[model samples]
Target: MRPQAAGDLVHLSAPASASLRTRPGLVVHRRRNLSMAPPHVVVRRGLTVTRLEQALVDSWPTLPPAERRAPVIRAVNDWLTTSERLAVALESAPKLVDRGALRTLVARLADGCRSPLEIWGHEHVFTGPGMPAFRRQVPMRLGLRTIYLDMFAERERVNIELDGSTTHGDPRQREIDLRRDALLATIGILVVRFAHRRLVHEIDAVRRETLAILATRRPGVIA
Candidate 1:
């Protein structure tokens, strides 16, 4: 059993049996099939435990709504698991609580959204009518250095970067971003950035601005 952030509760899964007993600080989950295939279960410190993807899906419902997405997102970002594997684990848990939300999140991750801010932008601002289908996490080579774009519109040669809250206050990060943008600009890719605050609070405005920017980038459109 994995150590939780809080509480002494230990969750264990076993094949369905009438002899199972529940006690304080112990949670037993009886399943028709308790045995997991190879690679899905690992022997850790002499105890068998579900892999990261399976454990995430199985424990999704137990976490608070706000806290649930972080672990899954972090796991994916850290290369511990992929969105594809998570989707497979999710399929095994049809009755899981808030399953639809998890599915949506996985879909966004599969689309190359690496952060919560980008996910929010995808769902709220960067989509819908007149918005081009943006390719995300696009790689571009600038000599020896290669950089990945957050969102790229191929036809317009535009890149929209979603800046997090901490980015604005960090001078070093801002300098890095500026230099990166300059490099991208040399290749004719226009970089447009929106901060976390504006993206969340000014949804309609950001969408309008993005559309207008894309329009200006078109072949015959006037700025």
Candidate 2:
């Protein structure tokens, strides 16, 4: 996770500390020394800013339209506006890169989402395995109330859960999950269980197993 950095941090020169003080909702980050240029721009905890951020600013004035629009070039410009003194700092820094070629390549690895395939809530439902479909966290019934599921897939009423190591360790969690599954079963709703590692590492195998179960429930769907 990105550490809470002051939204308004300025670059500090070498041998100085980076700090932030939050006021209201905005953060004011600055270095101990005012005149010295920062050794480099850093974000989060001990993570240095990428060469791309530096390169873009250093050459922002001379950047051609095509070069400036490049992925790393663009990312650098975005960072400059948010980070103070970074644009000037970049101007004085050494050339971290010659061209933003790799950045462009990585940018192309987008989800390329089309109609009916985009996620409604990325915080909950996520993309996985070839980034094909949304991994819906199936809601489960526990006793008289409803509970949020860690991972879920639903077919009619059957909800499948992928339990991880963390889940089995908590006694209270285990009991709750067990009760939910049992309740689902009592209501004629199936709950197929799989290990989280299996779903992530051996996704195709898991898909095959899931499809097989679905095939059994509705035989003609596959044929």
Candidate 3:
């Protein structure tokens, strides 16, 4: 139980035998059995609730198709869960309306994308532009700190970072990001960052910019 934020409802898990009556300020979930392993369900402060991964899967059906990828990616990145667990949860849960789409998203998560924008960029830029395969979540050691780039082309020393509000909003984090960017620049890595809105709405411009950068970074490389 992460500290409950204000206006957060109590998510109570009950047996299937329990009554289905809805109560104010309490969201009840009925389960047939309670044999989940660790990380699926957790007991904190004497309350049992689904873990982040399970909660993301449970809420998959409620979201529109375009909105599903972000939550799943965020859950995997935040909770350190794997695509295998997400696959199993999706298999068992009946709420997933688009199973294939969810599985694709799980695959994207396995590929190192932490948000919907990265997925779109990967699919659009990597494949459509016939660019060489790029690595996702590329970890680099900068002294004692480890920074993960959203996508990296090792040969070209190019890195693409996706900035979402939740992840990069804090002033401290912003300063840290700037320092990291400077360090990468010193090593001849071309770091390109895109905001969430720009990536979603102005993808064509993003694609053009990426292709131009890649072309200049590695002359005659993209065929």
Candidate 4:
């Protein structure tokens, strides 16, 4: 329900209740049978709503392409839902129109690619100098808090962090990033951060620097 765009009209599953007298802002979708899967539908505080996974798949066909990418990535990355769960939900959806696009998205999600920026970086910056395979959204536990790296090379302990000014340029976020970098350094993981502009304008340089760093690091040094 949260994924649905803001609207004056409310969309209710038809099976939940019979349609009321003609109303301007209320619309019922007659296609869904919520009774078939009890777990998919929830009744709380007298409101019937579908699970996030179900809602995502059911709403996939209705969304425009760019709008589709963010929600799926956000659900998996920020919400901590597994890509496999999303994939399974997608598989069960009979009316999915963008099957090819969704399959590619699911595969990238499973590989821990969280955003369009990260995906673009993977294709451009990381692929050219590929000695060690980099893992996306690598998790690291630092004391009580857990931090995720944008890209990580397990054998060489090389971590590449992509920073967008809007996301990481704030003072608070910069401080947090510094602390995380310090923690990563303490564990002998080499950290390289590239600004969004660097990746956009200086990709060739970024690729060369990345390959050089990997070349210097000893093989088989586990993080």
Candidate 5:
């Protein structure tokens, strides 16, 4: 047979060639398409997975080198603005909005706006010039929770049921109302109720009674 070109190597023992082939990664190049990536591998902005991963790794030091407690005041202001809405629109859960914090935030917002008053009506009582008539807000909890009068004022903690004439129209309902008041009283929450006639026809007298109940809780009670 004629001699082969210079690139051709001298024939060696098959065992030697096989041993070299078995060396780690030596045969990898011989296996065509072995280095080709899997289908899940992705490219973005002309960057390959290797390049993207490298970029992310390099940015790691700068990404979390500092700890920051979010600025609550500034966060509220940012949320208040319509322009900033997009910044946090996708952030479904607000970090600062909780029962106590939300109430405090709303109180500040309410103080700045007159519309809140007209919109919520008479029940929407604000802290008067001197009296600390705090707003009623309950802590966020699961399920249908009721806000007792205590949430507003300790004096108002005693539940006072004001019934309409229709309540007395039915004798059975009147008895139920009496029983309800007694039950409430048994619970240690004082119950003083009044008919609609007394409440509407003699509002001043009713007001006096309401004030008296509140007075009992004043700083110096003989108890």
Candidate 6:
């Protein structure tokens, strides 16, 4: 299904005791125990709806593999749900399809990887031997603004930004990034950015360059 288009199909969960029949556009899911725990189900406009995390987990397997991650990621990024809560919800679903992959994504989210690009960098480019345990989504308060660094090597005071494809060729965004970098530099932090293409296609080179940069920033090292 296309991401922007809402499908007509609706999934309804009912207790095993309920005799609900699926219609043309409806799917009925029968569960032995429909948890009525507080916050699990709430009355909204006179209709009961499952909580965001439960709903996401329940509907995960039904979605095409490629389409599952974005919704969960967006929900986490928007503050609608958290990776911890999602992990708890996932624990109850031992039979979930692609459970391992979903669990891995949630773990990455808990590590403060916000976007797909950041997650990609975490898996392929920014991690492994010789890499410092860089902090992800680190917050730096500068005057009135709180800027979040994508990946930060604390000792080196270096921030790595994984720029997504959407930012490519966008002059306005580039200027804003430059200004932010300058602002960071004022506080003695160096900002390094890698575009989406290089992070994905030139994995080895990116890793090497990141290590080299960190090496130069080490306390006793000279560039």
The whole-model lDDT of each prediction reads 0.89, 0.44, 0.75, 0.76, 0.38, 0.88
* Candidate 5 structure quality by residue, lDDT tens digits, 1-223: 1224454333211222233343432221122122225331246576433222222222222222221111222333344332123223213224322324333333443432212221122132222332334333322222353323322334444554445566466989879767655554554556556665665567556666666665675567744
**Per-residue lDDT over 1-223 for candidate 2, one digit per residue giving the tens place of the 0 to 100 score:** 1123455333322323545554565434343333332444445466554233443444443444544444332343344332233334443534535324323222321222111111112222244432223234445555678765433434434455656557556899889778777777786666777665565566667667665665565525643
Cand. 6 Cα-lDDT: 0.88
Clashing pairs in 5: none
Angstrom error at residue 146, model 2:
1.4
- Tens-digit lDDT track of model 6 for 1-223: 1254566588998778888999998999887678655556877698887778988888888888988889999999889899999999999899988899999999999999998888898888877898999999888999999989999999999999999989755999999999999999999899999988899999999999999999999898877
Q: Write one digit per residue (lDDT tens) for candidate 4, span 1-223.
A: 2345576456555554555443677665654555735776777687777767766776666677768777777888676467888888787675678877887888878877888778778767787436567888777898898888889988878899999858787999999888889999999998899998899899888888888788778665342
lDDT of 1 by residue, 65-184 (tens): 988888888889889999999999999899999999999999999999999999999999999999999999999999999999999999999999999998666999999999999999
Ranking by TM-score: 6, 1, 4, 3, 2, 5
Cα RMSD (angstroms) for every candidate in the order listed: 2.3, 14.1, 4.5, 3.8, 25.3, 1.8
- lDDT: worst 10-residue window of model 5: 61-70
- What TM-score does prediction 2 earn? 0.38
* Local distance difference test, candidate 1: 0.89
Best by TM-score: 6
Model 3, runs deviating above 4 Å: 1-41, 62-71, 98-101, 164-178, 195-198, 219-223
What overall lDDT, based on C-alpha atoms, would model 4 receive against the true structure? 0.76
Model 6 alpha-carbon miss at residue 182, Å? 0.3
For candidate 1, which ten residues in a row score worst on lDDT? 1-10
Cα TM-score per model? 0.90, 0.38, 0.70, 0.79, 0.33, 0.95
